[model samples]
Target: MAADMAREVKLWNDKREREMYDNFADLFAIIRTMEKLEKAYVRDVISSKDYEPECTKLIAQFKTLTTSLKDTVPSVERFMETYKMDCPAAVNRLLVSGIPATVEHRASSSDVGTAAAVAECVQHFITSMDSLKLNMLAVDQLYPALSDLLSALNRVPQLPPDFEGKVKGREWISRLRNMGASEELTEQQARQLLFDLDSSYNAFINSLPKSA
Candidate 1:
């Protein structure tokens, strides 16, 4: 009599299937990490300085991954339920709210003007970055995004007059103004503008009052 053999198991049968499974795994990891980050922030185990960047990155990644997985993973909540994931906090933070807890707290706080300004600044920063990523390089397109960011920055009285975001935004707006509206940013210009925007965004987030 032959000994019984154990069957080998595979989660995916083809290259496409493997890729989908990998994406699903990445999605799970992002949600789980977000849950941990949310808990740590609530407990004050991590400072806002450390928390915001990580939360922002995770939220971005989650959005990108979910968009890619839209066909296969029609619903994130369904996927979570299928996986038996118990992460209400992560669900709220990543899905329902789609913003960092610190930002939500700030928006809810009594300082409505500053809170609203900060939120506007954050939205403009994200919009500018997304536009660049999508190659929306026309001077007209880029100028408005930067202009909005600068306007939002100006609304925040807490930021100094010499803030880096303000200076870089003004410089970029000036450069764009001289160009024809239909003219597009060169690859180099786009890259530099993205870098400046990212730097300014970080500075803006860091300059936020911890209590806010």
Candidate 2:
């Protein structure tokens, strides 16, 4: 009985060890993918429309995985070294930076504040619209998307304090907050929200400086 228990324990340990390595493999892949994405964006091989969402998704996944592996993967840089990974761009993007490259480029412009804010507003607007299109209509999903849009709208120095986008975004966020996190918007609600977003996006575009 003692020998059998030992064998079973060893097998269980082996299984868990394999799982950990699998997660490491996933982490490795995300990093490599991010590096390629960064290069593609720099080379203009991919449009910002195609790059931003994929970059955002990878960053989110990287964050979640790193959080889970905090105990075992104490340092991401160290992990990279162990794996012989040479993705400096991914290291900077996933580890050092918080925002996407599109936003980062705008932020480094001569008119840093306005440029960055405009980029942020555009990004959030696109994110919100894409979320709705993807049927991510649950209260939790919609609330954050709208909230981020509102926040970004507020940051644009050229936009009025009561821009239509800001007003509509706030109203939607309020409605979403009143619902349970898991609750989905009805079809009519989703339609109305999409209409409002489209209208606001057009208005936002018109509000931009002609040179921008």
Candidate 3:
């Protein structure tokens, strides 16, 4: 009976962890979507009135979800320490949560799921950069997400050759460094920044192979 109860508890804990992981994934997706919407608005693809309310709503939702995840971190950490599963999903969570896992956390062709997560994170960061204002404050806010995305990318052992070409980490790192320059940019400089970021990101996205 004690063994059975322990099994049940473990099952419940696993389920909770999976749910939280899903929540984390959803939050990234929401943030990227918000970034894209803002890009659309700035590009005049959407009206200001339409963009404002929707962006505001999404920001509120993001805050709430962020708070919930923060509250749950302790349990998640405990599970990670206890389980020590070196699988791709665990690696994904470690990356998303900014927790450093063992150096063995690498994605091979076999670890397609983790590779996809890493890819998604890279794509999301690139997308978000399009909406950045090319200002110090906006750029500062961007660094943490960029760091996280890079950390995730570093964990991939070997990406499929074609997929790798699509997510050029060096180009991204250089673009980020360019944006990080502290001097105030002129209107022309700002426009150039936007153009560069959008062009690089779009080309990366377009280069991705179609799903099987």
Candidate 4:
């Protein structure tokens, strides 16, 4: 009976380890995504308005995940004390990962004035795109802002020399130009174009230089 209990406890401890590992992995992914956002914000690839809110949201999620991990630690500690077991492999692995340090370092590095301004502009543009009401007035408002964003993105010095070619050598811009001049698109087509533009904009954002 003692041997059976030990085996059962071992199984439970292993299960908990795996669960912890999974949560750690999820938190790591979120951290990486936040890193991407920070890099874009720093390099003027995104706007502050967009970056601040998005960063806040991700940080909240990160906090919640960490809290969950913290709450589990006491239980794991009790299990260790009761069973005379060392730390589980998952927790040990997490300690080795050093995720907290990584997240803090990445976020701190991106705090710059110019980047903050650009990040704000990117956010405003995104907001403007989202605010379109499918009416003629909205369409008219969107065209100039869309053109300006495209122009600004193209001018960002951090973009690689061949960036345009990689994104089909300004074909996306041409699509925008055509739409801008013609203004013949029905409401549905206009909305779809805005969606496409957003996709293109994000693709550009992701293409900017990644942090080392």
Candidate 5:
């Protein structure tokens, strides 16, 4: 029975990873779409050299998240064969209560969940960035769902070509073949920063006190 439960847990974990595998990817897409949404925020919130540093960092960071989503998400199907929604409260509780201490600071900012929700939006953006930094932490604690997904892939006899490499050690990803094409992925390039900055602006608007 315990062995069965363990399989259940593994399946549950795999299911969530599978979900995030896509979610993380989808979030990256939203991040890209944010460019369209955050234009004004970038113009206002980030200014001069002050924003430049963050510009460089955000681009790099978003790229990392994008790559993770692209590569790790599909591994879900490659890993386990089921979605485990059997007991979701345990996982949901963690999402509600389990943001890291560092993130708690960001989430609780005098800025978040207010106004045009700029603070909240920035807070969520930052928190999502943190989640990426944390390897998108899983379960109620720090179980490496990503690593587990990798292990599970070993069982698939004919893994997809994309699934066969190690992502941890890669520092450079190039579109060498498409490099000669028209333009960049748009989502992966610097424009995405503009979107996040714009979100900040909207958040700033949303964050404004209502009594005014």
Candidate 6:
């Protein structure tokens, strides 16, 4: 059954599904590392013995992603190498000897002023965005096949326990202390203010993921 499943995987696989799975793997890795290090600093951070089971599941999913990447990446690279479909001559023609060349030549100090540079830059920026949008639209039509290959390319390093709150929290506390309040706030007043602020910020952050 495992061999049958491995042989059935294809280059035209559903990229979005694989991407979502890869994202799960990434988050799991981060959570696993983060929790492990946190426990080292403040012992007994996660009291759950079930964490081992979660690790087992994460490894199984990761193996599936790794197998898919091994099959797909080389095939995609081969496609790009075979036909040069990625950077076609037509796209290059935009810069090779035409409007692009004129713009490049116009960058000479004698030919263009600061204001003209700004204008040209704005025009180029607009052109670039337009081209990018069109390119993505075409790519969306093609099969959304960017996944599985770059599934695990970039791994964000986990925070070490000692550096977690020690570095950033200390810096922020110093900045807050340096602000020099009119008088030292009483414990009750500070607690009330902090509670209110936390409530407000939590609400704000909660709204962000959906609205952002």
TM-score head-to-head 2 vs 6, winner: 2
Compared with the true structure, the alpha-carbon lDDT of candidate 3 equals 0.48
lDDT tens digits, residues 44-101, model 2?
Answer: 9999878866787677567656755789999999999998999999989888985578
What's the C-alpha lDDT at position 7 in model 1?
Answer: 59
Per-residue accuracy of model 5 over 1-212 as CA lDDT, tens digit each: 88877764332357767766566555444434434223423456544334322333343344335445555545422222244223232222122322212223355565332221222233334433444344443221112222332333333333333432212201112222334333333334323333433443354335335531
TM-score-based ranking: 2, 1, 4, 3, 5, 6
- Output the worst ten-in-a-row residue range by lDDT, candidate 6: 147-156
Cα lDDT tens digits for candidate 4, 7-37: 7433235876877767756665655576676
Candidate 6's C-alpha runs over 4 A off are: 1-11, 15-80, 85-99, 107-109, 113-116, 123-212
Q: Clashing pairs in model 3?
A: none
Candidate 1 lDDT over 61-86, as tens digits, reads 67656755778999999999999999
Model 2 pairs in collision: none
Candidate 3 off by > 4 Å = 1-109, 117-119, 130-139, 146-185
Q: Rank the candidates by lDDT, best first.
A: 1, 2, 4, 3, 5, 6
lDDT of 6 by residue, 1-212 (tens): 88887886543468876775554455345334433533442364433334322332333333333324454443423533554444332223222321222233456655344323322322322222222222322222211111211111111122233332223333333434544443343455335433433443244234322311
Worst 10-residue lDDT window for candidate 2 reads 7-16
Q: What are the Cα lDDT values of the candidates?
A: 0.83, 0.80, 0.48, 0.50, 0.35, 0.33
Name model 2 segments beyond 4 Å from true: 1-37, 40-91, 94-110
Residue 197 accuracy (lDDT) in model 3:
47
Candidate 4 accuracy as TM-score? 0.35
Residue 201, candidate 6: alpha-carbon lDDT: 29
TM-score of 3: 0.34
Candidate 4 segments whose C-alpha is farther than 4 A from its true place: 1-51, 54-117, 133-139, 161-184, 208-212
Native-referenced Cα lDDT, model 5: 0.35
